[model samples]
Target: MKKNIVVTGGTGRFGNHLKSISTKHKLFFPTKNQFNILNFNSMLKYFNKTKPDIVIHLAGFSRPMELHEKDINKSINLNIIGTANVTMACSQKNIKLIYFSTNYVYPGINGNYNEDDPLKPFNNYAWSKLGGECSVKLYKNSLILRVCMTEKPFIHKKAFANVKTSFMYHDEVAKILFKLLNKQGIINIGGKAQYIYNFAKKENKKVKKIYQNKNMKIKVPFDSTINIKKLQKIVKVKF
Candidate 1:
């Protein structure tokens, strides 16, 4: 059956791709100006007006991992507190909340982390995302996607040969998103596990291969690939 849905943070990379898709359900992509997540009343006002049955919370601070380290307050306010406000609004309106999290929430080493696996965020960025997860987990009608997705065309000119990941494109994940709208609790959403160099090489042969070094400022995860068995079973599509 068709349902009314609202997507927050429609301006983001994934959210932009999501707007291009055609689905049976009606979707509303409200800009932050229209539905500011930090303002709980704004979310409630939008929900009350639209009467949506589902709210995809995609508004959060991300990108430039350095920002999280430098501006911890903004990270906490946007990703953590903003998400909590969204959850509260969703709960009051009885809307199914689908949150966008990250695969970085899992311990980097020892890949194949599942939904039930123990979490240990790699950096301050991941920690902020996990903080949002905590609030969404409280709501009974919520689905958390610990997604491993990135911009298409392989943004980086260099790929980490030593680091492994399950990086899928934003559009790829958007294609399968509608199928999992009604799912509750958390789901590990990603692609097949592969070395970063291997994944990027397929798209750009000129991409340079680099290994994680101790001198590097950023904390590189040796392996942060997530298991997508549950997602495959539901979508009936092999990754």
Candidate 2:
């Protein structure tokens, strides 16, 4: 059956990929003006207008990890508070909420982390995402996706040799999203566990190799690979 779906960050990287492939569902990718996640009134108004059965909450601050540290207020408002507002609005209307979280929520020391693993965010960015997860978890009708995805064309010139992760391209993830919508609770989404360099080389053979350094300015996870057995059972797609 077809249902109305509202994607909050519909104009973002992953959201754009979803729009390109979405043909079966009635999806509404409203801008911040149309559906401001930070404002409960705005969210309620939009939800009332659209009467969506599902709302994919993707509006949040991400990238340039340093920004989270530099401007904690922005991170708190957008990633934390904004998510809370969305969750509250969804709960009020009894709408299924799909939240996009990060694999960084797990302690990066161990690889193959599962959905049930205890969370310990490595950085400020991860912490903010976890904050979002807290609200969504309180809402019964919600799905939290601890995803490790990146854009296609592998923009990075030098990939980490020592670090391991399960990074899937946005376009690849977009294909399997519909199967995941009906799922509740947390689900780890990404590709097979492998060295970051190995994954990058598959897409860009010319990509150089680099190693994670302790002295590095940014916090790099040595092993943030996530186990996706649960996701595999549902979608039957090789990550």
TM-score of each: 0.97, 0.97
lDDT of 2 by residue, 89-153 (tens): 99999999999999999998888999998889989999999999999999989999999998898
Name every residue pair that clashes in candidate 1: none
Model 1 weakest 10-residue run by lDDT: 212-221
In candidate 1, clashing pairs total 0
How close is each model in CA RMSD to the real structure?
1.2, 1.1
Off by over 4 Å in 2: 215-218
Task: Look at candidate 1 and tell me the lDDT of residue 109.
Answer: 88
Structural RMSD, model 1: 1.2
The local distance difference test score of each candidate is 0.91, 0.92
